[model samples]
Target: MIEEPKTGMNIIVKTVTRLTTGLILLFGIYIVFHGHILSEGGFAGGVVIALSFIHLMLAYGREIVLKKMSEKVSELLGNIGAVIFIIIAVLGLFTGGYLFFDFFGKGKPFNLFSAGLMPLYNIAISLIVGAGLFTVFVTLVFFRSEKK
Candidate 1:
């Protein structure tokens, strides 16, 4: 008798991944949101976010992961993030007479809303980095060399 190949990891890894995936994702979001108030910033948060998705892909198969976030969607998100950043910059230029100028008033120090557009920038950066990294990962995973 011949044994069939498995598409994903064993049951234990799957169960563990299922339990931790959401937590990992949530942590990434937290980092993105609270970055200004803490040590970590958008880049760090974005990498964490991408890691969550990558974790899912590692535990499950590509098919399952792709269903959750298709290649098109990832590409679209990255574009949207870039557009948002550009819009923010343009708005700053028009309002403050400079690129990325902080027109909005900064709130109380040590507060969530204290960073006057920094948070928005962080969000955009996070989206870009997360989507870009995930797309790259997917591409690398799916890439295959043809042999004649």
Candidate 2:
């Protein structure tokens, strides 16, 4: 007997998405890490990460995706990202002797973890963007549900 239809797109679409979402997430991370060395930056990479989750939602529906990542978790993560960014700035003032100074050592050239505060900044920005966007999407999706 055929299985009942689930709460998402067609099987084919879901399969394709499953295959590609991982790659998309990987690419997003790469962009965030190599942003300084390459063209992309935190904002771009964060958007990509957010899009990967969004892609899953589009293919799998909010219930399934939300189960994996709850609204509170997303909001909390976004808040943590913001806090990290602020802490970095504040630390710079006290440790580096200037506002937004590079307190962390600048390691080898063209290497990961080489740019002192830059990588940290990128990570913080990525967290903020990715979680913030995903939270927005979840809120809007659920908002509509309550109305109905």
Candidate 3:
């Protein structure tokens, strides 16, 4: 019988990782969305989000993680996040608000969508941080040059 090439860690490790990865991702999303009301904000939430992917990479090896999130995709997402953040900031100028303005009306306290553009800003920042960190990690880990 031909043995399959080893791709990741032992079965127990993989099983535990599979059980927790989704929870980690969900926690990151929660942090991003509730940032305006809660203490956790864009950067913190973004790091958490990035950690989820990083955890996957660690458990499954670089190849599988790359397949799920390639370098190109990560770079593109990082750029898109930056653009979205810039657009949101610039939009304030046209609305007669400050450079970093909150254009939307504040709803009930401690509620999602209450902080207007803050949530959007948090989301944009999360995307930038998560994708950018992952891209950097991947490039550093996978693209080593061989000496002649």
Return the top candidate by lDDT. 1
Q: Rate the local accuracy (lDDT) of all candidates.
A: 0.91, 0.89, 0.86
Better of 1 and 2 by TM-score: 2
What TM-score does structure 3 among the candidates reach?
Answer: 0.90
Q: Could you tell me which residue pairs clash in candidate 3?
A: none
Q: What is the per-residue lDDT of model 2 for residues 39-81, given as tens digits with 9 covering 90 to 100? A: 7899999999999999999998878888888889989988999
Per-candidate total of colliding backbone pairs: 0, 0, 0
Quality of model 1 by C-alpha lDDT: 0.91
Which model, 1 or 3, shows the larger lDDT? Answer: 1
- What TM-score do all the candidates reach, one by one? 0.92, 0.93, 0.90
Q: What is the lDDT ranking, best to worst?
A: 1, 2, 3
Q: What does candidate 1's lDDT look like per residue over 7-30, in tens digits?
A: 888887888999999999999999
Which sequence of candidate numbers ranks them by TM-score, best first? 2, 1, 3
Candidate 3: lDDT over CA atoms?
Answer: 0.86
Candidate 2: C-alpha RMSD after superposition: 1.5
